[model samples]
Target: MNSSYEQELCNKKLETILVIDDSPTNLEILHDVLGSAGYEVLVEMDGASGIEQVEGNPPDLILLDVMMPKIDGFETCRRLQANPSTKHIPIIFITALTEAEEKVKGLALGAVDYITKPFEQEEVLARISLHLKLRKLNLELDKQKQELEIRVAERTSELSQTLNELKQTQLQLVQTEKISSLGQLVAGVAHEVNNPIGFISTNLHYANQYIEDLLILVRLFQKNCSNPGSEVEEQIEAMDLKHIDKDLPKLMSSMKLGTDTIKGIMQSLRNFSRSDGENKKLVDIHEGIEATLMILQHRLKAYPKRPAIQVVKDYSVLPKVQCYPGQLNQVFMNLLANAIDVLEESMIENQYLNRKESTFINPKIRIATTINKYQVIVKIADNGKGMSESVINEIFQPFFTTKPEGKGTGLGLSISYQIITENHGGNLQCISSPGEGTEFLIQIPF
Candidate 1:
């Protein structure tokens, strides 16, 4: 026998059979028949006594006799089925009552089988064997089902853990790329600041030396001007004092203008840099945009092939928006950079053709912003060669770039979309077609 069969057979043995009958003759016959089949026999003369015996020590199967005094076999079976501990034991009804209706009643009351009087010993043995086999099969199925459920739960937990790890790895890669882009932006800003500062330093030194000369003349005038002196007048004439007086104010004004330029550039740099703050801030959207433009100004400079790209700003005064300024600046940088690159490519093509009046002769970028009742809208449009339908559809997919392999990581627009839509509650959309220019529309809630 298989281990499964041995386990059930050892545990439930088929060794003990209980006989309940009022007639002594019937009881003796059953005892002898069951005993000859290598089973131990226990007898109860009444239904109540049989129930008592079964409750004391539950058997794998019970042989119940009907039509007994006090409580009947049906009542005994009902009592056994009521207890949680004894409910699963199979009950077979053995009765002298030949009425088919009585047998049906016994079976309906939780009896597994019904044996009529004048039953053959071989038939009794065969029916008992069948019911025991059915009982054992049910136990095996239940055990297997529990084991399958445990395995499925373990696999599900492992899959969930792996998915979380993948997401973490993706986030790390995004941050690394962001830092690399920031370095390029900083270099551009430094170049812008260096131009004005360089001139300011030289102008201040010249202004200081001019002041020393003027002061010496004033000292001479105060000390010796009570009496007229020919040499003093001669010295003033040689120095061109009148001309110095006339140009001194203009020099100071020029210096002031240079200082103001440096200050504006520094402020723009601060605004762009401070946007990476941990907390959201109420900020002037236009200021953030101007800062981004400043960072990108170098890209708009004229080259031999093309004049400077014209930028038309149509800004509407609106309420300040609460947002992560640094992140929004990143989105602006991405969109504007793409526009400038596309325009440059077109300019190169136009130069090669030597068509001074080509369709994209003077490439232009237009930025317009407006506010409705609940949202702020920004549109950045470029008059360069526009994208095709396929390019537009896939633009926001991660690592999907049209630029040459090393020139573009394809993550710019995709990361920008994540910043606007996921980081802040906003929408970024692209509008373009072949031979037409491209427009990026951004909307953020108030």
Candidate 2:
């Protein structure tokens, strides 16, 4: 039986216990009992030294004597309990006092167990073993809690990183979709322009040939008429030389003007269709607005049944801005398109309806660009049905749109905001009131 018990003790895990007492005999006895029970023991002959030892290298449990010199066990326990570092260490009071009041007082002072001096050896072992086991369980619980907290923190960090990545990806997708839509719109416009340009080009060539032939005939007549015979001069006068001179010049001028207009339209289309990825360059802000306007020209110059919106260009002779021209062009397109939509809505709702004459309200879009010391500001304003304060506030928020169903994707302003702020380090703002129209101000640093 003794050998079996010895084997069991050897199998037990090692636990450290501190014994504090003024009497060397009591300290030695406590150390031997705990040590034989498979606990590693430390003995202190003074309460002050014992407190220092426990603080420096905390043990699993402490057996403290109630009466000691300089400092008593009660005082030591109080001090230990007060210190956060050593407070959780299980403490037992070993005193000569067998009174219930003394045990109660020790317990009140944060002692986990109380043992009377002149105690039976069996009772001493039982209490010491129980308290040591409790200390072991507490240490294990604390270790598991610490590990759990670390895991939770790690998971939270990973989740935050994933969320940020997802947001970035969503923003990128939205921008890509916007660009694709713009490309498709450009292609459609190019197709529509081809028919008018083809015919105008053909007509101009024929008209130029006709003018050349007519000029040759006139020169021949002038040369011959300088020294003309009477018969030839009489024939030219009868054929109305004055009428030909007057009518021919007017026809040439009209043809030339028509050709020039077609050429201008084609040039605008080419500028709008130019592929977009280039580094920063000195760009004329007006050119960006013009390109955007060309792309929206079809929309603006629609049937007369639709309101004829007047585009007022208030461009200043500003210095060229150092920026990505294509991105700025996109910003212009979004702003101008929004302005047109607003103006169209206003025309539909004729607020100035009580006039004597049935005069159509001329909606107006105004674009202005200015240069400051270190930044360029582009403002696009529209005299149309404006927005409420609440609507204006959320205009830049992602997926927010004022248009009716199936009319808008709601990513235009939001993506424009991100491109200006995140990519170009610029600012986009709006000023609006209900019937007073709206203005968008975009500022880019040089």
Span of ten consecutive residues with least summed lDDT in model 1: 167-176
Score each candidate by Cα lDDT.
0.81, 0.82
lDDT digits (tens) for residues 1-446 of candidate 2? 38998798788767788999889888778777777777889989998999999989999889899998999998999999999999999998888998898888889989999888797778988998788778778889999999999999999999988986776578678766666676677668767887777788788778778877887887887976787789877987998877777777787778778767766766665565445665777877787788779768877874645656789988878887777666677778889999998887776566356344324467789988788887888899998878999998899876789899899877789878887888789999999999889999998897
| lDDT of each residue in 33-73, candidate 1, tens digit only | 87766567889898788878888976667788888889888
TM-score of each candidate?
0.54, 0.55
Number of clashing pairs per prediction, in order: 1, 0
Best by TM-score: 2
